[model samples]
Target: MIWQLDLIILVLVIVCAIAAINVKDLLSAAILLGAYSFLLCLLWAIMGAVDVAFTEATVGAGVSTVFCVSAVFHTTRRTTD
Candidate 1:
């Protein structure tokens, strides 16, 4: 059961990571990155690292995403590359 949950979270993390990179919209990419972080936190929790998971969930999903979105808001969403 636990292994299955871990696998699901892992898959979700991977999918979110790919989506974050492939999405054309900067805001959507940032949101997907946050979702990836949240999935990573779930994976960490299942691995028995509660403290690390909590930190990742809070900082990665919350603070980092906020900063990224704010940057996107201040600048243009289109990328040259």
Candidate 2:
């Protein structure tokens, strides 16, 4: 049962990571990255590493994502040819 949940979360993390890299829109990529970070935090929490999970949730998913989105907002969303 627990392994199934871990597998699902792992798959989602991989998908988010791939989407984050392939996304054309900066905002979308930033959001995907945040999702990936959140999934990682969840994975850590599930693995019983509360300290790491909290740090990743606060730093990776929270602060880093906010910074990325802010940068995206201030700059161009589209990539130049």
Candidate 3:
């Protein structure tokens, strides 16, 4: 059961990653990136790395997502490439 949960988390993380890259909207992509980080944090927690999971959840999901959104706000939403 634990292994199944881990596998599910891993799959979710991968799906989020792919969606983040494939999405054309910058805000959506940033949000998906945050989701990916959260899934990773869950995986880390399952692996018994509490400290790392906490860091990933807080820094990756919180700080990094905020930074990315702020950056998008400061710049144009449309991408040239």
Strongest candidate by lDDT: 2
Cα-lDDT of candidate 2: 0.92
> Compared with the true structure, what per-residue lDDT tens digits does model 1 show for residues 31-58?
9999999889888889999999999989
Query: Top TM-score: which candidate number?
Result: 3
Model 2, 19-39: lDDT tens digits are 898988889999999999999
Decreasing TM-score order of the candidates:
3, 1, 2
Error of 2 at 68 (Å): 0.2
Task: State each model's CA lDDT, in order.
Answer: 0.89, 0.92, 0.90
Candidate 2 local lDDT, residue 4? 86
Question: How do all the candidates rank in terms of lDDT, highest first?
Answer: 2, 3, 1
The Cα RMSD of model 2 versus the native structure comes to 1.7
Please give the distance, in angstroms, between residue 61's alpha carbon in candidate 3 and its true position after superposition.
Answer: 1.0
The C-alpha stretches of model 1 lying farther than 4 A from their native spots are none
Off by over 4 Å in 3: none
lDDT of 2 at 63: 100
Find the 10 residues in a row with the least total lDDT in model 3.
72-81
